[model samples]
Target: MAVGGGLSCIKYLMFAFNFLFWLAGTGVLAVALWLRFDKRTEGLFQASDAPSTFLTGVYILIVAGALMMVVGFLGCCGAIKESPCLLGLFFIFLLIIFAAEVAAGIWGLSNKDKIVQDVKQFYTQTYNNYLQTKQPALKETLRLIQFGLQCCGTTGTIFDGAADTCPKKEGLDAFITTSCPAAIDEMFDSKMHIIGGVGIGIGVIMIFGMIFSMMLCCAVKKGRNII
Candidate 1:
């Protein structure tokens, strides 16, 4: 009786966890879509010379969200049915995702400096092109960024050859002289902690899901053995 009760509790817990996991997956999908289509980020994608790195990251988020939804459904059904096969499959899926997340976290942390340098290079090159060609899209992007960040060029100085976005007229209260590179860095850096916190939170939730799935799988196996 005690064993049955314990197993019942676990099953319900697993169901609850899977439901939350599914919601998290949906949230990820929503955020990814927003990033892809948001007006603020449109310029990043519209620029003729935009880097594939950013685009690839967005795509990965979309794929991960989709996979999460699939796995979450599988887990919920497996727990409810107490099916060993489904539970085992769920375990495998989660293990793969956990491993991949760990690997990505390690790689990103180790290459932080390189990533920053690459982004800076991309921005500088793109800005130079905007200056020379004055493409409408790039121009609008620059204006948006400058106005949003209250920044000017890469160095935020007229010496870098100010665009119309840069404040040329003196005594303008809305003017900003800080360079875009520094502004960009500050903008992104401020969010790093929030990003890190969310990543860790998701990782912890995944770990719990793995543990629940494995436990339920064992419970199911034991029940079969007794029969």
Candidate 2:
């Protein structure tokens, strides 16, 4: 009976962790879908603009959300089972994700200026290449690329609540369908399947870890009661 009680406590912890992971995962999926649909249908890419900072933010969120879900699920299982193995596995995965997030955030913040400059340089070089080739079709494609980039930055600012200096031209929506909609559509689309794939893999490991951890903990509790 004492052993069972300890195991029950472990189960409660697992359930809590699982709930949090699911909530965070759902949030990520919703935002990714919104970005893909909201902007793509509005001709946000026909004007030869750059990709927006919001898109970058979206990508960052996706990656972080995925890691969080993985770790959270593992933690839930570890706590419920009272198993040392599950607990250790959860801890290890969490540590890895925490370190990665820190590194990526730091690097991105530190190299913001450099990244901006590099993107500008690459944009120029690509345009010049199209010019030399003298391909009308390629030139048109380049125009779309430029528009995507511009919009990426401008949209980011607009969303940030800065003064809206960006031009909102009429027929822009029609132009997207007429000019090229697919290109823009792909930009915001999140690879949920990919995220799911990752989730599945991590989930398997988490399950085993949790089981081991919970069992170990319960056993310890029982032993203490006996003593």
Candidate 3:
């Protein structure tokens, strides 16, 4: 397997790339888990009526991140072992993940408005329930939402202000503030380009990975045939 030539160089390069990719996948999985289960946010998701949009996205991250780690491990092992069979499997897994990512991007774009509306509804319900019950959990949830979005109540007016949770703005800014719903929509709109850029970058990386796997697999087979 060690054909000891340029193919060896490709093998090491593949191993290094996949090692870094594995680390990145681990980091992504960690962050997603934290967001989903942190003490402050866990209550929000555990409720019977939790919104599916946000929760669904987190679950997707968890699954994708885990898959990435597995694929990366397989890639690293395949490269080091120069096993054509392992490399073939790695290429298949990578292709599947890439396809899934592309599909997710398209689905997200097509349903952006629906996603925003679903989140807004959840926020509105939480805001109202807090006003009536004044429960600490609800209050903290609202605080997290307001602070995270850097937004205030629905109207941006005194009504539903829930000032304690909203970010502090003084003078003119207090009167003219962004509402949570608007902030949510604006966040999605503003980040569209960034999301797209990231997706394209990942796509290019996957394409290169697939190409490398196939190249290495072919070279390994050729070396075996020669020997």
Candidate 4:
């Protein structure tokens, strides 16, 4: 009876953990979509002349979210069914996710400065292209970013023959107080900490999931042996 109760407790705990994991995955998916579609960040995606580090990061988030949802579902099913095979599969998935998360976290941390610099350069080129081509979509995106961040050109100062968004002097309707590079750095820095914390938190949760899944698998095997 005691063993049965312990197993039941573990099963419920696993379910609870997996449910939260699933929710976290959903949140990640939402954030990734937002980043991909947000007007202010659209310039990062439209830059054809530069490497798309920001877009690549968004893609990674999307992939991670999808994997998390799958793993979470598998874990829930495995725990509910008390199936050794499913639990083993869940363990394998968790291992893969764990390794990937670790690698992503390390890469993000190491390339923090580079990512900011790349973004700054990308924004500058995009803005310049917008000036020459006057593409409505690019113009609108640049305007949104400049006004939203209260930032001007890449250096935060109006360039010679700058666009309407980066006027030489402050106007009644338009004025940029910050630079794009500073704004981008500030925005990404805050987001990076939040993302890093969430990643670490998820990684820790995955470890627990793995441990519990293995334990449950062993229990299921032991029961079969006794039978």
Candidate 5:
């Protein structure tokens, strides 16, 4: 089989893309596992009465990560072997993943306010519980939220009770800083554009994968050397 210059380049690109996809899958899986085992959050998972919002999201990510790995494997093998069957399968899985992503984006957009409110409520509850109990688990959890968000307590004012455990500040910022609730709002408001951009970028890459897979499949079917 004599593969042409153009097709050979595309084949290599396909392999590269699939390799990166595999790495991304690995990263997602690692993050999911971390969240599953992290001491501060693991306690929440152990309790039966614990809220399911964050739990559900972690499970979804684990499944998605695994699925991406499988799809990526198929794509890589198909490209390397020039197998029409494998490439077709890869295309099908990519299409399904793309559809799922689109559906998720739509759902997230439709329930933006609700999701933000729920998260804020969860933070508020955690903060209040910490103020009353002074438990280690709650303190660690509070620290995670504060440091991760770079925000103080729910009130955003220096007078907030949980401010002591929040992210450290210097001078004026030590007293005047954004609140956790405000940070959450920014996540759904101004910061949401960054998330949307990432989504679009991923979607574009997936489109390229699907396109290249089909193209390679056709090029191989026509007896063009792809290897």
Candidate 6:
């Protein structure tokens, strides 16, 4: 009965892995759609013509999809080898990651509101602080903001074409003289990297689980004289 139960458990885990594999596939598709449509029309999204929130939502989905894929692979091995020890370990690791992802998702959902408010506040503060006293500088700053916003919503080429917006007047020439590069680095420097790192670490754990389960299966089969 113990052997039969272990085998059943392994079968269920393999199915679970298959489900997660499909889930990750869908996530990648969603990201592709966002890159194609939403990214190029940030201003439209802000005006509610299109859903811009997907940009952030898709990022979360990508991370979750990766985690599911790793966990599913580990589960598959555990089921194939009929090793309760491996499946049990895989479940424990999955639970830890699942908890963390849920927490992060919750925080992200809440933070979306906070981010919009904060950006608005920053813009207001900058206008009040710099608009009057530095009228010449203020115009330059607005130009920088416009360029930055455009580049942020578009391609990296926006930064290269910045000289086209130049030919400044009086003190404004100093503004053109100053360089305001778009924050292209933010894409990779996101906090998502930490989650991805953890997922990779968990993948290593799955590798060990697969090896151990295979050896255990081999040993049991040999001792029982069973194929």
In model 6, residue pairs whose N, Cα or C atoms come closer than 3 Å (at least 3 residues apart or on different chains), thus clashing, are none
Tell me how far the alpha carbon of residue 218 in candidate 1 is from the true structure, in angstroms, after superposition.
1.6
Model 5 worst lDDT run, 10 consecutive residues? 40-49
lDDT of 1 by residue, 55-151 (tens): 6666777787788889999999998888889988988998887787678667656765565565566667767878888877767767665665667
Better of 3 and 5 by lDDT: 3
Candidate 4, 1-227: lDDT as tens digits: 11265877888888888888888888778778777777657556664554467778889999989889988998899888888889898889889988988998888888888888887877777788876888877676677677656678766556444557553454633443577878888888777777877787888888888888887778778777887
TM-score of each: 0.84, 0.47, 0.82, 0.87, 0.72, 0.40
Ranking of all candidate structures by their lDDT, best first: 3, 4, 5, 1, 2, 6
Better candidate number, 2 or 6, judged by lDDT:
2
Report the poorest 10 consecutive residues by lDDT, candidate 3.
Answer: 39-48
lDDT (0 to 1) per candidate: 0.73, 0.49, 0.78, 0.77, 0.76, 0.46
Q: What's the alpha carbon RMSD for model 5?
A: 4.4
The C-alpha stretches of model 4 lying farther than 4 A from their native spots are 1-3, 129-138, 158-160, 166-176
lDDT of 5 by residue, 1-227 (tens): 53467998888898998987777667667766766775434644654335566567568768877888888988899899888899899999999988987887787688777767776777788889988988777877778767767888877766855666787788999888898888878745753574456557667888999989888888888874434
TM-score of 3: 0.82
lDDT of 6: 0.46
Looking at candidate 6, the ten consecutive residues that score lowest on lDDT are: 152-161
How does model 2 fare in lDDT?
0.49
